[model samples]
Target: MSGQDPVSSPARTDSWSSKIDTSVAHPARRYDYWLGGKDNFAADRESGDAVAAAFPTVRTSAIENRRFLRRAVAYLAREAGLRQFLDVGTGIPTADNTHQVAQAIAPQSRIVYVDNDPIVLMHARALLTSTPEGATAYLDADLRDPGRILGDPQLARTIDLSRPVGLMLVAILHFVKDADDPYGAVSRLVSAMPSGSYLTITHATNDHMPPEILAAVGDADAQIPFQFRSREEFGRFLDGMDLVPPGIVSVAEWRAENEAGPRPSAAETAVYGAVARIP
Candidate 1:
């Protein structure tokens, strides 16, 4: 047990999930519940319901945010010509993960996913399945500790930071709060990347919502602290970087022309997204 690979070992997976205190709500599980996933527990459902009660469009917001993640990764892999990705705060493995989307375009693409949740770690094996020509790794790390993530040996072995890589902060930074200096942490990671590197961010915002809509939420996401920012504040995170076309639009409208159905309105989604290059 001492030397076993936690991600690939069934016993380790059970060990990890067993340690989770199901009585309390967690961000990862809450998010999973909002996305109609079965991995969440009663506490997560309770939390999700509270948030949804306030923001009636929350479930739609969650779905649209995921779509932004997929489109951003595809653009990085296909359009930006990036083969390496560092996706921090990657939640539960879904239908089209970062590696799945990237490797579909470039079979040789490499990716490293980082998340703090033990449940996410339990599912790490699912995230690790990569194309034979490519490679994938998971780091059980927290976003607050950028140093640990940036300097991790597991990450170093998977993707070379000296080369261009895609840095994904999708829907995770808002949880960090201003006290943690999310912007500074982001800058540290950006500095580590080479000039051609790209950053993709999708964060919840109250900028589009009307006054009553903002009041409706009433801190329903209390289980996890969220600093709902403005469109300008979200854009500040990408300052000095070159934004991709249709910059900093609602999550639902970002390159959604190819999507099947009509995109949700900005106020309904209430999430700002953008992809920018280091240049």
Candidate 2:
């Protein structure tokens, strides 16, 4: 988990049409479609519809995951006294983005967003809007290559490595299969951060889903497969960090703002979320 040499240049041209394959369904684009975004194609809609058909709660899961992200960012900035953030696997920009949430709490908070998707890069301007007091930057990098993300010049300019940072990996790790060594990749990123930094995650899980629903979702033709983990397996990703209160609960139960109204059950949400601090 030691630091790797920085890449000389990590920026890429923002021309996404050449890079994006409209014929195939991309996970990010499909997620965008699920979230009622207009940045998706017919393929994405088709795939997303198929998955939604299989698991009627997929849309709910996506929306709840987003809510979890907003709450986590607010907690990190306001409660945890954090000012720097590294949000990897950032999908298409939507409401209540990481920078927006953090900067709202602390105007001077700095953020660096990382993603390999060409579509996300095309929409990077939406994510780069920063308040005069704070700064924001986007890196066209992959999650598997933590070195490239950690070493990018843009990231270095925005976030200070010596200070505490909020590391966000929401709804993304399921894409990293077991063979890709997701745990090792996450460790490398966490190791690069200074002590007191926090890690926030919201991941899809089958631990609480009914067998029939799981079977239906499993039969969907998502071009890229989702590797749903158990609650215990998801907790392992936060191994070296100290868990916050109400540790590793369903997304709906993670320090929510309101609990008076009826809410989706854990089985319906099918997502796990948590925040932990580096000791």
Candidate 3:
């Protein structure tokens, strides 16, 4: 990573203090609580459990999503020789995090994690570890602020944009509504990377769940104020790029390491994952 103008981890200077809100449920903390972490509050646990009740597979889906992240990073680092990663919307750290999986495959793999959640920022200080030959840094910025991410000094300090980087956006785009120009957000960031760079993204969708499940998740998402796009909408994030084999499949089916039951219908799973290369 290389800082454009002394860009450093957003937490490098009390960044965590600036954005934390304890009164409400934030997605990052809620996700941390789901992954069995200690950084969340009562509000987050309540919200998480409520959502899990509506969708009984919520915890399983979360774990599968994380496993997909590990598989993607391992493939990128060991098979593709990808040494750097810019993981946007990285929720709270958990077992087999991006840097851990990548560095395990390639000791020199460097990673820069971006998330706007203050709680995530606080935990990232301890969770985002790197190997002796590799490095890891965290960025306290929102997904909407791609410019800040690209220009962050801490990111620049560790990553070299000129090389092929694995841009991981697993399970994060659902929080980005259509009004936010999610496509534009992805474009601006991917545009900054070189041709060989890869884009790995997973999004929540309603195609798999029944109407009741959809309605429940919809109500919950409304509380968070984000939109879950359809498959077509999710594919738009890959426009102008080349999707690899098994294009735009479910997270469980995207080059999966083990078959986890027959792939659930899109609506039932509610999550879509894809790996693409910037042409």
Candidate 4:
């Protein structure tokens, strides 16, 4: 955002840092640890290690998930010509973030990143530098409160709600348990986007796991706030949108032909991703 909004992510984190309880493991921090980011704490490392011990390819899974995001953003910006993006649960800014990748393809693309973690926001302002042609801003908000996010005046200023926007919920919904009404939160966000807007997601899944790995994953899940859904259960978030080509496959395999190297297997990735056109 324009450095004018007081509620912007960059300005709020310094104050919010005081309230962050580093003793407990947060999903964003833990994921940062998994991705080899130095912004994470000891608790995040411990939690990430526990999950990695149970599933050795989790780092690969995380890497592939990021790859899936780049592919999706390229498709949205290059092929679909979507000029706006809303990336929720955007973790610590890394290489090829939504804004970076989209702006690379379309210099005028506008992006708003949403993350509840102040640490993530702190790193975002420092690292997620936006292009002069494009606009980029971060929102320190929770996914559970869709109305609050959509109604924010700063969001309206950054992106035009009337235009087609790419709604990205990548590798974050697993933290939203059923009790929190994840479906409702997704539906509300989808309702705000206009027709031709796309909803892109890469969610953790247990559909391809063996029983032994499931047991290990379950052990790790006990320590975190994760709920790996089956393929059928994951479909609840689709909301009748028209699926893009290669519908609902492993994150590593989604439009992977565009890449140069070999891709991870479905069982190895264990994360399902897809892009859909909002009809």
Candidate 5:
């Protein structure tokens, strides 16, 4: 498999569920395309383009989310001196992935990626390469099933829950609507892990977006409403965790390599990111 082509599967040409219905749009594939990955179908591209047209900040928000993941992983591996990571909702493999960024800082860093998307799982196996001293694995699971993720025997093979681990949910929880009780899901996952572990997240919000842009996005994709929450709602996800310096803020404002510039205009800033530790 070359760099640009989507990773091919061995005898699993029919692996994807027929009900996957590539005719409609999906959050993972659309996000993969936004991150310059090749795992998305034409329908996903079309829908993503429509969303970008409506909300011009979608592309920037996607990129900023990726950057936040890189920065958070670096902090866990370096400053926090963590060696294990459990990245849920792991998207299509892209540059500076969790394993890559973490192992770059500490080659012994071990990481496990979990995602329910077949295309992402295929790419993950192909591209989520681990260092000689590290380990990596991909599990086909959804964020809604944190129990399945935490209790999976395979997870124990690479990560030691007794030790500190980084739990990354970059740009994923927003897709989990309120009825899903995203807060409870997050709490369960964090509670299952041990003390000193870190929880890093990035989410989309309407708190910093204009009404016109929000309305346009609403019409662009009716199937998956891009539900945006307020800053206070986003903060509730980190209630029990020890928030790191800078606390919960916009993705561009969270330990950015560059200086914290003026906040983006309401229409341009729709993403928020933060890191916290379980104590």
Candidate 6:
């Protein structure tokens, strides 16, 4: 990660701080709490604890999902030769962020991160680190508003729309219920990218878990709505795109690396991940 602090532009502080509601438990904060991050509130911790109690492997699943993200980004940067990235639903910053992984392999890589959480916006500086050769920017936007994201001038300035981009939707689509037209939202985002662009997704699934476990998870997630999709349903998100090798498998099973050592069972991971290319 670059040592520079977040951009200190006055535009970032306009109305963003007032929109923060710490009283409610947000998915991003709850995710940070699960990853042992300090940028979470008491409500987030309580919700995270409840979810962990219901699903003992929730933390493991989170860790494995993060590993999947690193692997996917490295592949896009090193193998696919992608120089631009649009990472929507970017959670709180952690080790090997998208820009870090991409810039490490290709210093000229430019990345733009999008998220709607107020806490995430506050911590956006941690994610804005850019290499001297590359650039990074954070946008406070929701996933449902693909048009707004596609039209954002900052995104346009950082990433060239004509070139191939790595569109990362990791662990975020599940939050968009069916009523919100998640499929349409994804298609709209994909449509904005060029032919060579790549889409990497990791979504929670209820496929491998037992009924009792699913019920418990459902109860725990009652505080905040989380729609766990089936494997087939999750696969639909990649429609019209050609999946990369080892298509749409459990998070731990996708390109299992020797560095990560032994892999966990699909039931334990409980998340499906894949990388697909626009044809």
TM-score of 3: 0.90
Candidate 2 lDDT, 1-279, residue by residue in tens: 001112211344334557889999999999999999999999999999999998888898898899999999998999999999999999999999999999999999998889988888777777888888888888879889999998888888888999999999999999998999999999999999899999999888999877987887877854786799999999999997899998899898898857445778898899999999987
Compose the digit string of candidate 4's lDDT tens values, residues 1-279: 543435435447668778788898777788777777887889888878888898899999998998899999999999999999999999887778999899999989999888887777567664346777888877778999999899887689889989999999999899999999999999999999999999999899988888898898788768677889988888779969999989999998899987767778898899999999998
What TM-score would candidate 2 get against the native?
0.93
RMSD of 4: 1.8
List the RMSD of every prediction in angstroms: 2.4, 4.4, 3.2, 1.8, 3.5, 2.1
Question: Backbone collision count in every prediction?
Answer: 0, 0, 18, 1, 0, 0
lDDT of each: 0.88, 0.87, 0.80, 0.86, 0.81, 0.89
In model 4, how large is the Cα lDDT of residue 260? 64
The alpha-carbon deviation from the true structure for residue 32 of candidate 6, after best TM-score superposition, in angstroms, is 1.0
TM-score, one value per model: 0.95, 0.93, 0.90, 0.94, 0.91, 0.95
Q: 3 or 5, which is superior by TM-score?
A: 5
Candidate 4 has what TM-score? 0.94
Q: Clashing residue pairs in candidate 5, if any?
A: none
The alpha-carbon deviation from the true structure for residue 217 of candidate 4, after best TM-score superposition, in angstroms, is: 2.0
Candidate 5 structure lDDT: 0.81
**Stretches > 4 Å off in candidate 1:** 1-15
Candidate order (lDDT):
6, 1, 2, 4, 5, 3
- Name model 2 segments beyond 4 Å from true: 1-14
Task: Give candidate 6 regions above 4 Å deviation.
Answer: 1-15
Q: Between candidates 2 and 5, which one is better according to TM-score?
A: 2
